[model samples]
Target: MQRAKFAVTLFATVMAIGLTGCGEEKKPEAPKPEAAASTPPPAATVEIKIGTVGPLTGSIAHLGKDNENGVVLAIEQANAAKITIDGKPAHFTLISEDDQADPKVGTTVAQKLVDDKVAGVVGHLNSGVTIPASAIYHQAGIPMITGSATNPQLTEQGFDNIFRVVGRDDQQGPAIASYLAATEKPKVVAVIDDSTAYGEGLADQVAKTLKSEGVKVLAREKGTDKTTDWKAVLTKIKGEKPNAVFFGGMDATGGPLMKQARELGIKAVFAFGDGACTDKMHELAGEAAEGLLCSQAGIPPQAASKAFLEAYKAKFNTDPILYAPFTYDAANLLIQAMKEANSADPKKYLPFLQKIDYSGATGKIEFDAKGDRKDAEITIFVMKNGKVEPIAVVKSGKTIPFDEFMKSMGGA
Candidate 1:
């Protein structure tokens, strides 16, 4: 039996036999130099910095982290796939900042991101923050994309550098108003806003539509961004005895407002815009959140891509909050633009971003001339038994009632 047991390739075996020559020691000739062979082409790699701004430290930190995680997960997947840009292996690094939902801090961080030379940005969840922060990005010629900020002025600023993955407040505000006027048949409603750009702007739209529909807006109240005790406003709202309360603000504040309203024995049906349409809102409002109404642009988070849901759960070990899917879409859309331009520079990719027509986690993602989604739909939900249950889908001037919507889902 042969002493060597390890198998060798045919060429290697032949070379070994020739070198040993039956175990005889033969005269060794001088070793010939190896022929010059072309070396395999080296892989090219480049580091691209991406900026993400949000209220990462204040009341909405959970939602901010969710948005940041969405971008992070997208970058992670792209890096894992070895995405190449401009003939170089592109490495994406996320640089996130906390605006604390303040317009001043938002502008400060926006300039910081500009100074850091980020190729693009995804952020400033509050429209109040995004509107002011966008100017900084525009001045530096960097692209800014937001997944959540819905205030129309954010895009109407005529800044070509600003883009969003979601629909505008113009669409969402009318949706809430229509629900109250046409569907719920409420004759009197009270409106409360956080007094920020997003909240007040949306409140104005709601109030206008309500008046047009002949629904009396019983009371219009204001709250600050940092407010936690809403008793003063709730007491004033209690006196109005409106059929419903329309809140224009983030969930961090909306949740407390809802809780206080319920505790004060004000049982008006609470309706809110997308700002408070989050999983966290349901939890924060507890049982009081039940039977509550909220409207979100497009489908529910449960309706996102299955693969995305699984991957998100695996990575974060928790369900996503509102806008995470949109954030993911924004990140990928920018990367797609970069691939089309063959460069990671925003100046090179901005034009491509303006014309993208791709299906994202949120649904068909195409931007109109104003940087708003061409025709994003809206889904209204009611909190029932600790879940935000989708009851209606409104689009194309049509409203699909809850039972019919479920029937459309194969009677789910």
Candidate 2:
């Protein structure tokens, strides 16, 4: 009887195991997706080209290099942020060409950018190069925004495609003239230029303004830009014995001129336009750079926006100068326009840029009817203890008051 009971229990356990296996087999599997839904979507890719032309190797190469570094930083930051344009992920591709600060070379590079189908250009730092390069860009229907090129003639031609983020030489020349007349009150001042368009034009404008302001113009002269020695010109300036000397060229000439002027004992509160605003001036002029003055666009370096100062220091391991903020803003303005227009095509973006009021790392950027920024500010720099120091900013409180500033300089 015990054997029979054991057999029954074993049979029941076998039946339970078979029933559990059948229950597991009855469960359904998940369905396979359709072929159309199974394939992965296309990879996201969008490219926008930004071109730059500057003196990568020559006199004033440092300034060009700084400008390029600032722009590159802007591009890198934009990419890391995953900037999008018109709902599409955007990537910035920078193509820089060394124009060597030559007008012909600038024109060649501008044409090359046109052939390469870039959306816009960011440079041609020297006014001498920017003046000629602008013509080609205008013809090619590509817009160019310059940060350092301060020649007023760039926008004076009324090219719809041209714009400047910094103050012009016209504004700078008059500001220096007024400062010399009102602040220092120099009785007699001599003017000199390196004969480049920027140099000559700036000198001439200052002479005219100073003459109008009842200040005596002792002498006006031109200097060679390529020469390392400026003793001959310094001798001429020394012979004049003016109360002050105004140089219209860049630091490449201004430095040597200051050094030679000191050797000749021609110190009379020397001042120049933004061209002379460089640490190299101190190196070139030595002790003569003390109290040297220059007028540039934007606030003092110490007062620069926190973001700009920190990024510049981190990238370059030093302080930034006048043009860095302007370059950063110029690129930001372009990106803003691209976003507003919802297209990278210039034809689509130009109109939007005209009406866009962009607040950038530099300041508030709003263009007028003439393609000129409306509220641009010009800041002056003074050298002290072999360092460039910010002095003051000539802003009209709220807006730049373009018509008024131009009228003050007889440029409107």
| lDDT (Cα atoms) of all candidates against the true structure | 0.82, 0.77
User: Could you tell me which residue pairs clash in candidate 2?
Assistant: none
- Model 1, span 1-412: residue lDDT tens: 2434444466688989888895445312211110011112344566678888889999999989999988988887877777778777777777889999999999999998998899999997998899989999999999888998877788898988789887776787877788767777887899999999888888888899889989999768999877899999899878877888999999999999999889999988888887787767878878878788888776656666767777899999998887898888889888888988889988888999999888777667888887887777678888778877888877655677856654453321
User: Please, what are the lDDT tens digits per residue for candidate 2 over residues 1-412?
Assistant: 9999999999999999999988666422111121122223324545688887788889878888877877877876776777767776777777788898988888888899998788988887988899889999999888898988876778989899888887766777777777677668888888989988878888987898789989889667887787678888778777777888888999988998888888888868888887788888999879988899887865544454567777889988987754776777777777789888988899999998888887766667888776777756776678989987666566642323334433333321
Taking all chains together, each candidate's TM-score versus the true structure is 0.68, 0.68
Worst 10-residue stretch by lDDT in candidate 2? 28-37
Where is model 1 poorest over a 10-residue stretch in terms of lDDT?
30-39
RMSD of 2: 18.2
